[model samples]
Target: MIGYMYILQCSDGSYYTGSTKDLERRLQQHQSGDGANHTKKRQPVTLVYYEKYDRIDTAFYREKQVQGWSRAKKEVLIRGEVDELHRLSECQNDTHWLERYSSAFGCAQASNIIKKERKKDN
Candidate 1:
């Protein structure tokens, strides 16, 4: 099943990141204050970025990676500046970025797809 990693820019200007099998329903939940506790309190968030994955685990892992990012890094993601994200993530051990995500997000196996793709052709 296809799943999505999404970024929401909240009414209060804070950002929230999450993953779900249904992006529309999740967004609606957040808008209606039935989403995550963080977003529920923030109330009325606008979806600003999303990435689709073939597996729910992949999406969930990406969500965790983005959640730990700085606002500027998230903004770069929202703006589609993938190079910037790479630059930011690469500053570490080149693996820490994704490692932290895989460990925290409970989808290490699925996230390997993204890392593999990155190692290919680019």
Candidate 2:
């Protein structure tokens, strides 16, 4: 059965992401405040974006992925900015970069050794 991943713009301006096998029924449930707790409290949500998938699992996976995204990344997806999605998905952080660098160069233990050597030198 086909499934859908949808994004709703809530009454309070926040976004909610969800997946359903029956889009119409699920949307009605959200509108009637019988949906998720998050949407129930933020009622009167507007369907901002949706994507169809071949399998329920795929739709559900997409829903979870979208839920973890930043508002700007979600907006990029909602606006159908396909090209920008790749760019938005890239997360640059010092810790992650350092971990990657350390793993690549086998420097995970080198840091401790360098610290010890510096102490000895002092």
Candidate 3:
């Protein structure tokens, strides 16, 4: 069945992300202090954003993903800044393989070196 992934802005200004088959009922529960402990403790939350999904699992998955996101990334989603999501998704200190190799030699030169290494191995 269809389900919803939703984000709520708590009275404390924190965000809560969750998924449910019944958005209205779930929201009511949160407002009434009968929801998850996190929301119950931070009562009086306002629905900030939501996305509908064809499958309950999909909604749940999205909710988990959103819950793990940083505040800035979440804000990007709330503001409907789709283009900024990718850039925001990147971890500041984490480096990709290409980035690590390219840091010493420029990107184009690093790429050529990697290609040469691969050819040598083959």
RMSD of each: 13.0, 6.7, 8.0
Q: What's the lDDT for candidate 1?
A: 0.85
Candidate 2 lDDT tens digits, 2-121: 999999999999999999999999999999999999999998999999999999999999999899999999999989998899987865554555565577665766466555756997
Error of 1 at 34 (Å): 0.7
Root mean square deviation (Cα) for candidate 1: 13.0
* Model 3 stretches with alpha carbons more than 4 Å out: 97-122
- Compared with the true structure, what per-residue lDDT tens digits does model 1 show for residues 1-122? 99999899888999999999999998999999889889998878899989999999999999888888899899988998889878877755436656766776656663775577678949
Off by over 4 Å in 2: 95-122
In model 3, the Cα lDDT at residue 18 comes to 96
How far does residue 65 in candidate 2 sit from its true spot (Å)? 1.1
Worst 10 residues of 2 by lDDT: 91-100
TM-scores of the candidates are 0.71, 0.74, 0.78
- By lDDT, the best candidate is 3
Name the weakest run of 10 consecutive residues (lDDT summed) in model 3.
Answer: 89-98
lDDT of 2 at 53: 100
Give the candidate order by descending lDDT.
3, 2, 1
Q: For residues 13-59, what per-residue lDDT tens digits would candidate 3 score against the true structure?
A: 99999999999999999999999999999989999999999999999
Least accurate 10 contiguous residues by lDDT in model 1: 91-100
